[model samples]
Target chain A: ADAAAGRAKAVQCQACHGLDGISKLPDAPNLAGQNEDYLVKALHDFKTGERKNELMSTVVKPLSDADIANLAAFYHSLKP
Target chain B: ADAAAGRAKAVQCQACHGLDGISKLPDAPNLAGQNEDYLVKALHDFKTGERKNELMSTVVKPLSDADIANLAAFYHSLKP
Candidate 1:
């Protein structure tokens, strides 16, 4: 998974999670400098409904594993 | 539960989460201005190990429901 590609694909996430991985919205967690392992697990949980969130579930449903990995890598690369 | 009391109780959380509910550590999420319902639910999840975190699980273990509510109210009162 390319971090650069992830940055490009992360445009959809920018409304709540900032382009730099900081969150702009309430209830949205900042993604910068978070553990990549944790991020990937969270995306999987959201996609599978293990962690239930209306917006997150919908957003993660269409993401492939590579997409999830790339996003996690991109976010993890930023400063917290 | 008093938001004031929650603020007092939140001192223990200040190491990772700031007094204002912003997080200082990577992988530690900011709590300010989050949904009250979501906060309570997250506390419950942590306590039950549904959302597992070594620190959160231990932190929430001793809290009563009222304590959770107070903490939620206190964090929610802040600006994100």
Candidate 2:
């Protein structure tokens, strides 16, 4: 899917991060307006063994290139 | 594409997040072993307008469902 499409698909994450992409939960971090390069990498790190976060790793480990791009797009589009 | 593929694609995030999904940088976070639902939410939060992180929102605003899933998969795989 296109990143725009991915952005549209990312509705489930609203609880902690908020509808606007900010972290309402202290456990969560602000993702809005972060670097696309870093975002992509972070998502990837979670998937790969290189990163150690269990929840994030499992969540991201299954992502594809299209998925990564779309995620990057969705975050990039937000106002922060 | 599969989230596994997406997981493969997210290598760049290693800088701040570290290869282990743990955030060595104060500005960054520890994605490792985070909740899959929550991880997905954080990424989406960045992309959408509900959450408000400048860098993250811009980075994720483009993600697709595949992207979100892939990211979630990767994060979930981690040990935290």
Find the candidate with the highest DockQ and give its number: 1
Q: Give the TM-score of candidate 1.
A: 0.63
What's model 1's lDDT at B50? Answer: 79
Model 2 residue A71 CA deviation (Å) reads: 0.5
TM-score of every prediction relative to native: 0.63, 0.47
What are the runs in model 1 whose C-alpha is more than 4 Å off? A1-41, A44-62, A69-80
Model 2 ranges off by over 4 Å: B1-80
Cα error, candidate 1, residue B26 (Å): 0.6
In the range A2-75, model 1's lDDT, one tens digit per residue, is: 78878987999999889978778656766776667668888988998777778989999999999999998998
Local accuracy of candidate 2 as per-residue lDDT tens digits, A40-70:
7667766665445566666666678778878
Top TM-score model: 1
Whole-model lDDT, candidate 2?
0.65
